[model samples]
Target: MENNIASTDNDQRVRGYCAYDWGKSAFETSVTTAIFPAWFAYLFMEANGISMKVLGSEWTADAMFSAAVMIGALFVAICAPSLGVIADRRMIKMWWLRVLTILGSVSCILLALSPYLGVSVGWIWAMIMFMAANVGLNGAGVFYNALLPHMGDESEMDAISNKAFASGYLGGGLLLLVHLLMVTFIVDESGSVQSWVIPFAMASSGIWWLGFAQMTFKMVPEPHIENEMEPMGLIASTKMALGEVKKTLMGIKEFRTLFIYMIAYFCFIDGINSVTALSGVFGIVVLGLTVSGLIATILIIQFVAAPAAIGFTKLAEKWGTKKALQFSLVCWCFVIVGALSFAPLELENHDEYDIQYTWDEGNNTYVATAREGVNNIAALPDDGEQQWALEYEDILPVAENEDYDGGYAVKWAYEKDGTPTQVAVSLNATSLAALEGTMDESRFSYSISGGEFANSTGLGVEHPTSLGDGKLDFIPKTARSLVWEPLGLSVFFQFLLLGVFGGALLGGSQGLARSMFGQMVPETRSAEFFGFFGFFGKVAALLGPLIYSLMTVWFDSRVGIFAISLLIVAGAIILRNVDVEDGIAVAKAEDERNRASA
Candidate 1:
């Protein structure tokens, strides 16, 4: 009867631990991947146009987002190990986890206030809150992971770890689905999204994180510490923590394989983390996908990853964890290459329209002939409009009763000094009809200046030959045309397909990695060692974004993405040196020694 009670309690605790993953995943999916990036991009665009000048450098919204992640990761990397040591000595892992969880959840809630803070400071506030939330998330991860070794025996580690990841995917996916529906259906009279929708979604992620975490708090007891020291003052505790960290570093040779595996884990996980952190922004900036498309793709990844994580456990059982991880890393390499090569070209002509444009060099204004037969050519001023305009381009005569094939679509590609830039938008029949009765020639324009423009129909529309002093003024002509166009696929569909394959590997790799580490970590020193694990992960987190950000600023986003693949390949190479059985032997010996000492 007593054994049965104990088993029930153990199962409940495991469920609670998994529930925390479920709760916090809402924040990961809704705020980090799905809604928040899009919301922040919208706000940034509204406040500062397409790009912003920061510290004398031009930064796109995606660049700024990556920079924020880098900063947050750096802070967490510096603090995680010491905090881990302290929690180990004091039996305060659960308490520390709670504090960090609260911090993360509160920061998530405060993110709702960003838009209300006024356009001038809203983006900055959002960045600050996002960084704080990241710190909290990373900090909490150390303690959360520290609890893993105590949850189950080494034999059960893989299943438990993967279960947690699977639960996270389900939790995050469900919340994301709800948020997607909210955004899709809730719109104002102008068909513009309601202002409160995104903010509320952000707030709900926080609520979900905090609310579900209570299960973990209530069910998972603090791990008992043997021969624990009496609690000391904060400063003294910090000093002791530092001393322990130094001792661990100096004695690292005792656990050679573990440290080596950590280094290998650092490299490959950097690539994986970079992809997850930057994929949403990448979709928006490079693929020119709609926000809805990005969200839907992320939703697909979340659901797909859940099952994949479980499937990976079986793979690990069959092929061993190291081999399974290597396979996933290989898939990741292919994904990155696929992203670099993804260029889609799909433009079908509905009808052709003759448009005449005249450049006024004095005012840098481009005027187009609005009405051809009427001789009433309406001249439109450029006036900083980042869209293509036909002004009063006249349509050819048609039979009064003849069926028009949805009026004419004037497909114009804007060029600055003969280089195509930005996504192309067309002035369709509906837009032309709206501008027909209006004297406002500006109404004839539609935004065609943000993504990779493909078709140049030679409509004779005179666009600005220069973008003044903008940093993106010199985009390589080759980058626009050379990659994915010949594949006969759209970038949006490419992203969807990539997500499908990538998602399959995502959860499995992460789950198996954690389980492998858990199997090799000394149970007695789980918190202390997992702190080192968190340290390596957080530091890797910092380096990945910093490298990608620098590469993006110095070269371009494609180069940055290509750079990430090298990290994975290098990590996989180094991982080949690790012997899992030998590491497990060392861990068992250490655990037995510690218990004997106690």
Candidate 2:
């Protein structure tokens, strides 16, 4: 059965294509989502403390990372359509796919080298390679998706597309499990997970991707063209591709249904991506979820999404791909509603403070509880090290890395047993004046560990009395009082339920959306149209995040989520008008016309 494994009807070729998804998802789930962000942040902080000024604008590690992603997406958007034109005409989609895979995998391997380069250069190297990897991932996707129309007919497209996504989730989840173990168990004598473990993880992800991708290259054959264009000089070929793209643009009316469907695709997909991107940030920043907890939640989503994707294929078989997709979009709307209502329960005891430094009077100790605003928590993956106390003056203390806004030396110190605590926080005039202004009696309260300091000198660190509150605290508080407490669901349980349900919907909708598009595409022109699809996809990637960023800055994170949800609602409305049957008919007719002419 392996003989001529590239046959249109061969299940082996289908396996090969699915294997590619299985392979590449190692990068998506593990490297991009789990490891790279943390690794990059560490390197960036080591090189530039907290943030750096570039062109009078402050850039944090996260901002720089987002910029890199956007840059890669822009590159793919500019080139995808034109390249698709060239690939279709030249019958070289497989060739381009292979080339981009190498580029991406190699870039991943290059990421392993960043730690060796000193901190000064490592972050820059990581950023460049990260962008390069994204370019390869996005670029290869255009060709890979184009193969879907050729993979099977309209009847099978839903199963094939969803199966591939299912394979991706399974493969990614497995690899991420391996990585999670490696990170958790691989520790040194000092109890720190060795720096090399992360680097090894980065390299292993690339190797896994590159190694399994061979199954695709070995078994899948390049699609043959009846009127294949011969290779010409790069300039001439590019010119020809541009002309072909222009002709397709001019004939947009011929594919009016397909175009309409694409418009709907653009909005819903943007909303889905934006929500996925923001959910983690919301969990960490607003809900007090730790990094380990976030990783565990992502793993849960991955496993839950896999079977859910396959289930959607069955649903598509029963209700038609378009209808199935519409159902998923509506479900997504419900998910957004649930997310908006999520609220953390009010804090108890020391949890009431974002960063608390206090005097334990009975114990005669200085206590510090570093929560939301602190960094570099020195503990194992899942340890309750949020609060610690100093019995007397000790060298080891949780020092603040970020100075006050006006730039001053502020060091919190605990003294000998009799004295208990000593506070010499050097403050500039500006910070001192601001602190003095806001130093309301009800706003801050504290007791010196030993009466000697407070009773004698009356000197200590500034501690806000009513703490752990934000500008948007009222939103979660109101929701908790009205919705959560009544339902008797804690925020953690609420988040878990939201993630599992939303992830299932996300998997189903993503697979069904792409599958529906594949059904509408003319077999002869799949690559060309898929190029346009990729262009829109890349642009959507940039646009959705940008919209979330703008809305978050203007209002709150919840408001940003609300804005994105509206995009899905508008898309679902537009989708109702798209005629899937007419689009498929147009595609069949176009393919027939191409065959007859050839």
Measured against the true structure, the TM-scores of the candidates, in listed sequence, are: 0.76, 0.84
Per-residue lDDT over 1-598 for candidate 1, one digit per residue giving the tens place of the 0 to 100 score: 9999999998998999999999999988889877777688777766776577889997878788878877787777777788887776677899999999999999999999999999989998998898889888888888899899989888778888998999999999999999889887898764567999888998999999999999999999998878877989989988998898898899989999999999999999999988887786666655545566777788889999999999988888888888998899999998887776554343334121223333334444333332221111121223322222343232211112121122222323223232222221234446445444342322121212112222323311121111112233233223335544555456677789888988888998899889889889988778788878887887787778778889888976767888889999999999899998999999999988877887
Please report the TM-score between candidate 2 and the true structure: 0.84
Question: Distance (Å) between predicted and true CA of 541, model 2?
Answer: 1.2
> How high is the lDDT of residue 516 in model 2?
92
Best TM-score goes to which candidate? 2
Q: Candidate 2: which stretches are off by over 4 Å?
A: 1-9, 53-57, 350-368, 371-479, 486-488
> What digit string (tens of lDDT, one per residue) describes model 2 on residues 15-101?
998999998999998999998998898788778866789999978888999899889989988888889888877778999999999
Model 1 local distance difference test score = 0.74
Provide C-alpha RMSD values for all models, in order.
Answer: 10.4, 6.9
